[model samples]
Target: MWIRALQAVLDRGIRQGRLHVRFPDGRMGSYGPGAGTGPEAQLMITDPALPRRILLNPQMALGEGYMDGGLSFPSDDDLRGFLQIAARSAQSGRLPLPMRLAHGLRVRTKGLMQWNTLHLARRRVQHHYDIPDAFYALFMEEDLQYTCAYFRDDAMTLEAAQAAKMAHIAAKLCLRPGLRVLDIGCGWGGLALYLARAHGVHVTGITLSQVQLEAARSRAAAMGLSDRVAFRLQDYRHVPDRFDRVVSVGMMEHVGVPQYQAYFDKIHGVLAEDGVGLIHFIGRHTPPRVLSPWFQKYIFPGGYAPAFSEVIPRVERAGLVVADLEVWRGHYERTLRHWQQRFRANEPRVRDMFDDRFVRMWWYYLIAAEVSFTDMGMVLFQMQIARRSDAVPRVREYLYPAPGDDQRPSDTA
Candidate 1:
């Protein structure tokens, strides 16, 4: 029955022109006969142990299997994409009783504080982003923006979409040429440098990762933006300087529900009276006491996405007016798919740095995120906010620039 089910999946891929199978060992067999050629061409998994290892002990076994010559792929990255697509489809079907029971167990035991707080958060961040910078460099475009790209139209590429996201956020903030802008949890300094170099805005970017901080600072220096854009190795809670504008992209997931109000208050305290702030974050459909056990254990620790029900009240208590709230649920699905493709395309390099299980874990993470957005309709929100008493119009709408137009010059502070 399992063979039949697996074959059905392979057949779908074959019919779609997404897969082709061949045997390189010259062994005649009834199953999947004449799939492909060459030592690396065959889809050679006859033993049940390999598949069982992948399924039962997924966190560690997959990586060990890959390293110990248990599996081979023409492209590891491509394999990641293929498995992601397949797993998502498979997950859509009704899960068996055992699987449901297992899920329930996970939910019941979720969110116990385990590792020392600092070490736990650090490990979680490292597991996902600590892949060698070069590995990320292969997939991310020149700017290395590691967040959701905002697509202006269906035709825009991921890199172009990302650039658009940066431009969009910058424009909404109305950054001035000499105004100080703070980027909380700046990833790779893409947006910070964009504001500093392109718009002549002085920017300060804060991050917890020492590696990220160094890379961002170096990039700023290389672009001769050292004087205008600065990268700091500090936590957002510790940042004391006031700025004309503040922007945080894809970072709120790290701030759990208990800390949401404190996070907002910090932003409120750090903003100049006339300052505006933009928060771009992944949002959840329902409120959960904590994140999923599987995600918390294997993926992001101390990470929880809150719904608008939780966010709106917190923001109101912080004395901020919501200028705008835009949700892009579909774009994130497309974005995750793009990342999966790039990760698959560059698997050889990835394998060199991390073990097979690590690869599969990431594969699952990316694909599952894609599936969540598609199946559950998860949302990505960009909120524009300002001090509640500010005289700015409550319903102001600004036009985003067309792709080919010259980037608007920054306002003079």
Candidate 2:
């Protein structure tokens, strides 16, 4: 009975990709079109409870099972391929009625997972970003940019792409010499340093992660830009100054939906009357009213990727005029692909840092994130806002620096 019921769930959830499942009792099953014919995923169910767990809730159980050794794939590469296919098929799919109600109950009881209180917010940021810098360096650029990078040129290397991302945001800000800029949720101060050194602005960066704050401060001191750039261990809500520019990259996801208006209101209050601000975040193509259970439990404690529909109204209410909006599609897929490659190459070090289970979980997180960007209608949105009507130029050409107007780091190692 479990086999037939589980088979039905698999067929509905993975409609197009082929997943060949070998049951614990030596029974075999194939699901989806072209099943067992050049299948992308082959699963070995070692525990009898795996199917029941999946039936109760498949979206997250699969990852949990993999982490706990209840499920196995032939290889890590195949595992990623399988997850990509599964996530793609599950994008427009639905879980069983019982499963939906169970998940809903779990979400309601765990409301603490999505609230970013001042004290708790620091802990939450540390939960994800407090890892040693070396771990991130394994997959990220030398700058240690821990956010989505803009890859304007497909052939560009990750380092160059990251540098270009800084330049892109800098140009969009319409910066000038001696202007003051505020960086909310600044990870490692790469963007802040770039703005200060390249654009001649005094950059003040704030973050809740102590590890990130130290690294950023050290980097600024080493680069002799400490005089122009500074990093503080503080929350955005506590900031008590105004600036000519405000920029936040990959930070709003942690703010939660309830704080949307407060976030915009604070940004509006902080900006000078003629200040220009830009916000870059992960947005959904279709609004999922609820956050994912697995993501809330395992990856981001309070992260909720909001849709523009949920974001635009708050900006209007805060009296911030939308200057421009850019939707970045498929670029993050390529970025995650690069990160996955680097992470794969550094497995020996990762294994040394933790165990096989931890390594597997990390790989699954990276793979699932890549799948989200590629197939789940997930994209990056950069919204430029201003206080005064004429704060920014009317034309968009100012955002594109001339051939030699800006300098980027070398792509080659």
Candidate 3:
């Protein structure tokens, strides 16, 4: 029955023009069973070895299979998208049994997983952020903002969404002229330069990657905002001065479970009296017993998304009041899709630096991420936090159009 169901879906995908199997000679055909019989299909079809290769060495095999002229796709992105959908559905009920057992054992001996150690954390940070600046620049916008973007409307381009994100974050922080703003894990200094150049705020950005720090500094100098915005190659724990506002975007995932409290404490310690801190993060609906093995091994090694229950307690413990919480779930799906599109458009430039496997791996990661957001209804949260004694303000509110708004489209300039 399950096999029949799978075949039916595959047929539907091909019929709908969503999946097209490609032959070695570069001719595309429908993905039906008999479509593999033609002479053109000799490269990829009728060989048990092909499927075995793909399944056993998932990342490397798939990459080599595509590159060695053994397999092809009408659109690599769409092929992976459909494959992810099918895999997730097939594994929905049955695969979680072993996952549950593994999670239970990990939870039983929590400390046995050395993910929280400083060495491991540093290694994880380096593994993801240490990718060449030029490689990231291939797809990321000129500003090089690496987090989820806030779109004022669906018609808004990625550039506009990124600008909106910076403006929104700055407004939330209420940056005034000459006030010091601290950006934790600042990527490429987009927000820092935005705050300094647009809002006349003095910004200090910290990052673990030397590549990011140098790129940010050069960008700041080019923009003539070097004096107002500074990028430091340092960790958040070692930041020396207090600031009027603190903003950490997409950095919380790296803060392991055991270090959550300490992370918050350090942020709280550096924030001035009545200061505001805006934390933007991708959150999970429920706490996972363990990080996904694939993500831990391939993508972000020490990263874990936190549930609201886990986050709120830490904020309260750090003596901060959450004055406002805004959830932007669908916006992230659009943001990631935009990124995937940009990456695809620049594939030639990217392939020059990285191999086919790395490219496929990243594409799979992004598409799978998009599917996860759609399936689980996960959220992106931007919380306005302040010292406990600071009174919450009822400022005049401004609401933007929702995800489907037609006014904004295309993230390009």
Best by lDDT: 2
Per model, how many backbone clashes are there? 7, 0, 8
Tens-digit lDDT track of model 2 for 1-413: 77679888777766666778898778888777765433377889888888888887776788898888888999866786677677666554465678657766855654456666888788888888999888888888899987888888789898888887887888778888888999999999999998888878899999999999999999999999999998999989989999999999999988887778889999999999999999999988876545667777788888877778989999999999999999998788888988998999998998898789988888888988887776667889999999987888787766664696632211110
Candidate 1 lDDT tens digits, 1-413: 44444444344332211333332332322322233411112344534455555344332443344444554555645455444443343344443444446555644554343222445555666666665677678667778888888987999999899988987887778766788999988878889999887777889998877778788988988888899998987767778899989999988887666667888998899988888899999886655433444566676776766678979989999988888888886888888878888888988778788776767667667765775666544789899888754524343433343566534434333
TM-score, cand. 2: 0.92
The CA lDDT of each predicted structure is: 0.68, 0.83, 0.69
Instruction: List, residue by residue over 1-413, the lDDT tens digit for candidate 3.
Output: 32233234445433211334433333434443333321111123222345455433333444455444455544555555454443443334432244346546755554344346666766778899888888877777778888899887889998899888987886677666777889988888888888788778899999887778888999999999988998998778788899988999998878776787888888789988878889999886646544444666677777767678878888889888888898887888898889888998988777788877787677767776776677554678888898854433454242232566522211111
Better of 2 and 3 by TM-score: 2
How far residue 309's Cα lies from its native spot in candidate 3, in Å, is 1.1
Of candidate 1, the 10-residue stretch with the lowest lDDT total is: 31-40
Output the better candidate (1/2) by lDDT: 2
What's every prediction's RMSD, in angstroms? Answer: 6.6, 3.6, 7.3
**TM-scores of the models, in the given order?**
0.74, 0.92, 0.78
